[model samples]
Target: MQSSSELFPVALMSAELRGDLTEDVYRLKPANSPDPSVELVLTRLGRFGQEGGRGVPVILLHGSFSNRRFWYSPRGLGLAPYLARAGFDPWIAEMRGHGLSPRNQQYRRNRVADYARYDLPAIAAFVREQSGQVPHWIGHSLGGTTLAAALGGHYLGEEDVASAALFGSQVSRNYWPLKVPPVEWGGRMLLKRFEVLSGSWLKRGPEDEPIGLALESLRWHGLFGRFGDAERDWWAGLAEVRMPVMAVAAAGDLQDPAWACRKLLEQVPEEHRHFLLLAKDEGFSDDFGHIEMLVSKAAEREVWPLVAHWLEHQRLPLTTAALEAVAL
Candidate 1:
């Protein structure tokens, strides 16, 4: 494994769409897009296993208010390289409004729900066109939630995805009562009022902060944390996903309680569903919060391997009876 500093140079080398990037990284425009065309800013590690062929493509989705850069950050608990080593082509997606995705200069009024309908579907279409198959969807936090919505038929075209691995995602509409500080609650109210006054044309903030810092700020004062009527309608659609799902929860993740995670897993129609919780010693204890499982150093060693192993297992051909037996 490379040191965090070593990884920083690689991450810095990747282009930021309009921003300047270091020498080691170069940006490439993805093929077969009808729109303005998406740019895949990536770092090519050596080929995965033997044969050196392009591996199974996997698209990673980051949590709320975070960009694709979270997957490559030094402290990031990303599984891209590890997946690549395990014979998978790792692709990180920046949702339409979040990362290096082109800003909507046209319809300026965009909301978090728009991501489920637009950005994620666009990414899925792009992946299918380029990779020739529906890639496995891996996401954390709000990213996972949006992906769930997309898989459940909220997105257009209804692509047949292979499977999904969701981390620290919530399925119920009961997230608001989770005991936030008074100041944070006040900040959230202010942001909600601001969004209403602005007609949902609120601009996104900078993207260089730590994942925790970004989500904390959103939790305190951004539309990302506010779940309204639209969000409730969105969650209602998650019951449509019928594919096998690997739902993960960290024992210490207060943002996604274990009970809630189990409840969410029960909603998956797949008999091959599995739920796993990160142990406290894995730094998933009280210190590592919601988004940390994807960006924290501890996740690289602990959480990611479990995700990779589960993905590998799902790729195997199993009869319905065998799968049900395993689920049992």
Candidate 2:
């Protein structure tokens, strides 16, 4: 591994106030990335007067077909800002070709493998250098899955992460059709026709995704499949993860259901593993969907505070009605 300065040359893009909060954007160019031209954009939100998030660094990653905006809006009304207001230094990262991040040389070949192996380490190192404290990571949907891959593959360690919290993320959902050779072959062949999956056309979100990601999923759910690459078995690695972690799922999250999310949580094999299911039965008025669990007004009241509390204290209480095992 290279030093943070040698590996990631950063450019300060902007430092301005969004509402009452200060937003500083930086573009990091890493020399060791598989795709050499890759540039990742990180946005850190802070208060007008506070310094260095009071030594509590938080890194937030968005799901597929989304960007940093998923965690925050330009008007500064989102989880990132909410965390900032609560005296936590929150960094929001955009994936390749999403939001402020520009396309790399092999834009179409970008996969979670590349992100876990090449991108996340640099991001973690950069955050560590900028803030003297190890940061806690938070991810939504694909972001959470990528975080799992990074941790399971040993791309990150206890030195880099204080803890991790995943929202609306899971890998247990089975695509039975992909289990057959013929169906998997046909699906790959059809997906190869396009360089990217159009989020706009699919009405999934605001950004497009490399088809390599789609193809990668086929392999994961295919025959003899596991959640890992050729180099490491991420599923097996999950049991080896030592840091505190949490996985939250929504009852109405059809994309990544509560049952599937719980499966991911169960794999960690940690004594402090926390599982939260946002459902009407859990005291939330709504059985929040995949997107709603993070980006809705309901989440602002019920979910954001829990995240803050989790970062402050490692274990959640086992008695909260709104959370599976919520708050300190």
Identify the leading candidate in terms of TM-score: 2
Model 1, stretches more than 4 Å misplaced? Answer: 1-52, 74-77, 106-108, 154-159, 171-236, 270-272, 281-288, 315-328
Instruction: Please report how far candidate 2 places residue 279 from its true position, in Å.
Output: 0.8
Q: Per-residue lDDT for 1-328 in model 2, tens only?
A: 2223544578888888777788888889876775679999999889887754354999999999999989998777899998998899999999889999998989998899999888888899898888878999999999999999999999999999999998999999988888999999999999999999999999999999999999999889998888999999988888889999999999999999888989888889769589888888877768999998888888888888888888999766566553534421
Model 2 stretches astray by more than 4 angstroms? 1-7, 321-328
Instruction: For each candidate in the order shown, give its overall lDDT on alpha carbons.
Output: 0.55, 0.88
Q: CA shift at 148, candidate 1, in angstroms?
A: 1.2
Query: What is the C-alpha local distance difference test score of candidate 1?
Result: 0.55
Top candidate when judged by lDDT against the true structure: 2
RMSD of each: 10.1, 2.6
